[model samples]
Target: MPLTKEQVIETLRQVNYPGYSRDIVSFGLIQKLDVSDEMIRVHLVVRSTDNNVAQTIKRDVEAKLKEAYPAAKHEVVSEIQEPPQFKTTASETAGKEKFLAGIKHKVAVASGKGGVGKSTVAVNLAVALVKLGKKVGLLDADIYGPSIPLMLGVDEKPLYDGKKIQTIEKYGVHLMSLGFLIDNSEAVIWRGALVHRALQQLMSDVAWPELDIILFDMPPGTGDAQLTLSQSVSLDGAVIVSTPQDVALIDAIKGVQMFRKVNVPIMGIIENMSYFVCPHCGERTDIFDHGGVAKVCAQLETELLGEVPIDARIREGGDGGKPIVAMDPESPQSKVFLEIAQKMYDKIENQ
Candidate 1:
C-alpha cells in the first residue's frame, strides 16, 4: 500500500537537526508533501547563507526517506531561501521612476530551458489581459526563436515612422517580435553586447504608446541573453514557467536565481503541462507527475500563480494559429489564464 501523509510526517520526525529540539517536518520546513501510487515527492527549505546546515539537512532527509520506503519512487528537492532583509531608501528607489514610465508595470516570462511554452504563455497572457480591457503589449525577446509573431498570427511587417518602430496590433494587443523582422530562413547570431543593444533598441525605440502592462517573452535559460535583457529593461516583476518534471525544475531554479540576482520580484510560478486529463471519462492522470512547481514555490516562499494541464485543445490552438483564450474565453483553461493575469494586475497595481 502507498504511504499516507501521517506515515510520511512520522518518518520525518525521526530525522533530527543539529542542536535543534524540533524535527524537519515539525519545523514546518517540509512542504507540498504528496504521495500517490507509491511515489513520493517533497521539498525541504534551508537557509542558503548557511551552507553546512543546508547540505546536512538534504542528505539526512534523503537517507531517512530511502530507509523508510525502499520500494517507493522518491524525489526530494532542497532549496536555500534567504530571509528578506531591509534595504536603504537610496538603493530601493534607485530606478523606480525610470522603471515605471509610460508603462504601469512590466513582467518578464521566463523558463530555465527552451520548449516549455514560455512564448505561448506570453502571447496568450497579453491577449487575455487585453480581453479584460487592459492596454497590453507583448515584446518577444527570444531573439533566436521569436515565436510571438507566428503565435499572434501577425505576418505583415511593422510600419516605422522616422523616429520609432510601430507596434503591430492583433487581437487588441500591441505586439513586437524578432520573427516579424528577420527572415525565417536566416539566423540571428550576436554576442552578449550586441544582443543587449538589440533588446534595448526594441524596448526604448518601439512606440508602445501608453501600455498598462508590458510582457516580455524572455529567452529560455540563464545565459547572456537573459542577463542582458533583464538589465536593460526596467522590470516590475517576473513570472516563471516550468513543467512538472524534475529536469524542468532544475532549469526553473536557475531562472529564479537570475531574476533574484537582478532584484526583480518574482510574481509567481505557473506549472504548465502539470497533468493530462482524459477527455472521455474526465479522469486526471499524473503523466509528468504534478506538484513539482508547487513544491519549489513553497521552498522559495513565492506564490504559485496556477497550474495548466496538458490538453489537446491547447496544442491544437497553437498549431492552428489561434490561442485558446481568444478562441474559447468561456472554457475552464481560459478562465485559469484570465485569473492569473488578473492576480498579477492586482499584485502590481494594488501594491
Candidate 2:
C-alpha cells in the first residue's frame, strides 16, 4: 500500500509533547508533511524556548514514524520558535488594567468541533445571567465567523472614541464581535498571526464596564484563537459544549483534555441538543440518544452542568437574534439556560 499523509499524521499521534498528555497534532505543531511509499517527512514548529524540547519532539516524531513504517525513509525537521519578547512599560501595564479592571471573571464557552450550537448556549447564557441581575459581557471570539452580533440582533457598530472600543449593549449584555465591525458582505480571511492580535485587542483594548463576568464565545477547535486567549487573559475556567453523539462527543473529549492539559479548570459540560420533545403530543424522544454527555462526564470526572433539549424555539430565537432566554424567560428552554448560568456563577465564585 502507498503511504499517505493521513497515515503519517495518524502515526505521529503516538508521539506526545514532553510532560503533556496531548500530542503535537492537537497543538497544531505539525506545519507540513510529505509522504510517499519510499519517504515520509514532517515539519514542525515548536513554541518552546528550550532547544531540548524541540530536539525531543523531533526525536520522538522520528521514532514514531520509523516504528510505524520500518521500511520507509523518515525525515523530521523542526523550527524552534521561542516565545516573543515584549516590554510592557508602567503606563502600558496601567492601560491594560484600565480596560480589563472592570471585569471580574472571564469564561470561555468552547466546543471541540463546530455546529454544536456553542454560540447559542453562550448568547443565551449571558442573558440568563443578566436575568439574575448580574452584570454581563459577551465577547464573540469566533473572529473568522463571528455570530454573536447576528444572534443578539446587534446590527450597529460599537462606539470607538479614539482610545478604546466601547462594546455594544444588547439584551442587557455588553457585546463585541468582528461581525459588528465589518460589513455583512465582508469575509474575514485572517491568518493565525492576525487572529492572535485581533483577540488581544478584543480582550484588552475594549472599554468594558464593570461586570460580573465576560463569556468568550470561542471558535471551535484548538487553534490560534484558543492559544491567544489562553495566553492573553487569566481565564477563570472553560465550559465545553457538545451534543449527545459519538462524533460530537469525540471532539468534546478533546476540548476537555486540551483544557486539562493546559491546567485550566473544566467548569462543566453542557449537553446541547440532548433530546427532543413533540410540542403537540408532549411526548419526549431521544433524538440524538440520551446521557452521552453524562457518560463522558463520568469518564472525564467533570460536572454535567445541564442539558438543553433540541427545541425549534431555541433555533428560531438564535436565528431571529432574540435568544430564547430573554425572548421567552417563562419557557422551559429558557429555564434550563437560567439554571446553567447560575451553576456556572456558583462554580466561578467558589473556585
Question: How close to the true structure is residue 288 of candidate 1, measured as C-alpha lDDT?
Answer: 84
The candidate scoring highest on TM-score is 1
In candidate 2, how many Å is residue 348 off? 0.7
Q: Encode model 1's per-residue lDDT on 157-179: one tens digit a residue.
A: 99999998899998888888878
| Each prediction's RMSD to truth | 9.7, 8.5
What local lDDT score does residue 203 receive in model 1, on the 0 to 100 scale? 77
Give the alpha-carbon lDDT of every model. 0.80, 0.86
Pick out the ten consecutive residues of candidate 2 with the lowest summed lDDT: 81-90
What would the per-residue lDDT of candidate 2 be over residues 44-112, giving only the tens digit for each residue?
998644677789999999888878899989888999864333443566445445346679998999999
In the predicted model 1, the residue pairs found to clash are: none
